[model samples]
Target: MKFIEEVVVEEFLPTFRSMLAGELRERGLTQSEVAELLGISQSAVSKYAHGDVDINDAVADDERVRETVERLADGLETGDMSRVQALVEAEILIRKLERGDLLANLHEAAFPPLSDHEGPLDIHDPEGDLRTTERVLSSVRRGVRTLENTSGFAALIPAVGSNLVEALPDADGIDDVAAIPGRILDIKGQATVPGDPEFGVSEHVASVLLAARAAGSDARAALNVRYDEDVVAKLDAAGYETVEFDAEADVESAIAEALESNPQPDVLYQTGGFGIEPVVYLLGADAGVVVGTVRDLV
Candidate 1:
């Protein structure tokens, strides 16, 4: 079974790199400068300069590829895009092309049997639902890492433990959210992540985020931490808009009521109910921002 990465390395990389090299040269960059910008050796740049590398005409002629190359060249020349950012853009484009697009066509041309498959392959679709889920998972991972590394963050874990969660941009159900496989806990005074982040792994925090979204909040990420007067004070001190919901009632309804006035609160807290642990949720545009706010609490 051949992997798609092999095709990327053998076919896509050379062609794209050659095209980028040519674009940079046309933008008045020297060979050495192009090599540095593209992270290739000078001799490799020389080869690309001389047309010694074969580029797939399909990829080379793609408008998307051409636009990306031109944009990257302009950005690199004008110092607007870092090499890392350029690389990320290229990688994103490559993933898009790999999903039954240009690269998939090339792959089918190389292996005739793949074209006989039942339906379109979406393994690398950048705009696919699966990719949206993956982006949420990645956001959760970043937030979890931040919490794990923050000094004394374990102290924020409540009896039910803590969880970092993020939802797809158009999330409608719990399955569209990604969260820790198990609750994050305080183990020996250290924050401990139970396992890798995954979709459909979190129920409580995911529900809270979904409820907030249903209440007209545009937040896509949420983190639950222990609730206390001190934490509330800290959130207030940080200039975060705080809203309170009733824990005894339906969470969604209570949240909906609280949001009727504030609408976009940075913190949502609930007072204790029968056998229900009181918790505070931090919400933001993404997990990174949520985690950054959490770090400020420490």
Candidate 2:
């Protein structure tokens, strides 16, 4: 897919700049770190932070910087701060691309385009409504990258890819998923996890599971599995606590039941073609990270 440069931008620069400032603040990342990541000076990052520098000038001779900036601009157009966050993450992504720094390093990283996937809100909680849809998009992209780097599950990433496509992702679409961050699983049908049967598995389920596993939860952490009886039985046999739920179950009821009964934060995995609404329901409004699949794009 083409980058954001393909889109018209005369009226969007100010909005993008505003987004850039907020993204730096939200991530608790400093201008110094951005400078270091881009192989530049702290003053440069500070200059950009204070609107005293130009992003183009900072990385004028760097191809990677230009490419990253264009990609970030595409994300900014979504008008989602989380998209900005996703574009800025330095942990898994390369800090320096070619001679340029990551988009988050410059002013351009601040404003990613907004998207319509603004997920659902929880009624009992006031925090659910405050989250930006960009965050959900960022979380999903991070989850996908983490899954690719993990050692064991080579078999599942492709399934995750399929789920991502069916979900109509702007974050992990081929254009962005393979750029600066570069996924470990870039092939069409390679398994990230060994010996896992591919017949019954789906990409969305595998992607979420792999991402959750990478996020440092084992069987010890509270995990809620939503799937059909057969899938649940299999997971139960594998030591996962499986809850039998219809794919069409009310999202609120499912989340309340899972959370109230569990007494701890849990990694929720819904299988058997469950939709995206449940993901939004469970992750809620103040989600730090969430990974799940939908049979159809929301």
Candidate 3:
């Protein structure tokens, strides 16, 4: 199935943009400031912040593009490494738009082509109908309370999702869940195969971080690869940096270190780290923490 539903950008991008504008405003940043950060024009920044322009929809019409976005979104929301892999593939395809050979070159990439489903992908949750802020808050409160009442450490995982429309049901008032703020640490656990046209994990990391950032979390990407320096440099170019841990470091230990390293507590996002294995560990051992998943593809 096509992992990304068609209406994802249409329904979620506005909220994402608004959240970004709010961040800029809260930080006392001007359009010029944003323009400088993204290397765009001041006018473009104004238009972007004011909801007059969107970078996502400009390329949203392409089915493959949309699906890739969805994959990343899902991977981030749910912490599913497979979904992230899907996103990486999508990104490689999108870059084809800039290739001199374009279609001819893409035809040789030998990646799985996107499905033909061209509509809102069904993401069913019967309880998502009532989307009041209070309802959301209450759910979050319950989850937080559960965490607090638990033993040693508690981790909260929100539902995996692309749009708040679908995510709200799972994370209504997640913003106010815990009294202590969380820190987001995104991890890219696996290494990219050289010359591989598909880039999935990184895209998954980006999408989840984007959503977490929108939800008022301070998010950063992390990776520990043989080419750590190069990876860090690339992420830095994109306004992000990956934290490197020792190759022998245990995932849980690394996660703990990452959490302790961040001065302010907001949200800790560990992507690419040992994938579901760490998740299983976190669930079994860290009952005090609440864990959630947000994803498009399983």
Best by lDDT: 1
**How does each model score on lDDT?**
0.87, 0.34, 0.33
**What TM-score should be assigned to candidate 1?**
0.63
TM-score of each predicted structure versus truth: 0.63, 0.25, 0.19
Give the range where candidate 2 is weakest over 10 consecutive residues by summed lDDT: 279-288
lDDT of 1 by residue, 34-140 (tens): 98998899999999999999887888889999999999889999999999999999999988888878887777777775654434666565786545655677788
Superposed Cα deviation of residue 51, candidate 1 (Å): 33
- For candidate 3, report its TM-score: 0.19
Identify the superior model by lDDT, candidate 2 or candidate 3: 2
| lDDT value for model 1 | 0.87
Sorted on TM-score, highest at the top, how do the candidates line up?
A: 1, 2, 3
User: What lDDT score is found at residue 127 in candidate 3?
Assistant: 37
Clash number by candidate, in order: 0, 29, 34
Find the 10 residues in a row with the least total lDDT in model 3: 278-287
lDDT (Cα, 0-100) at 267 in candidate 1: 92
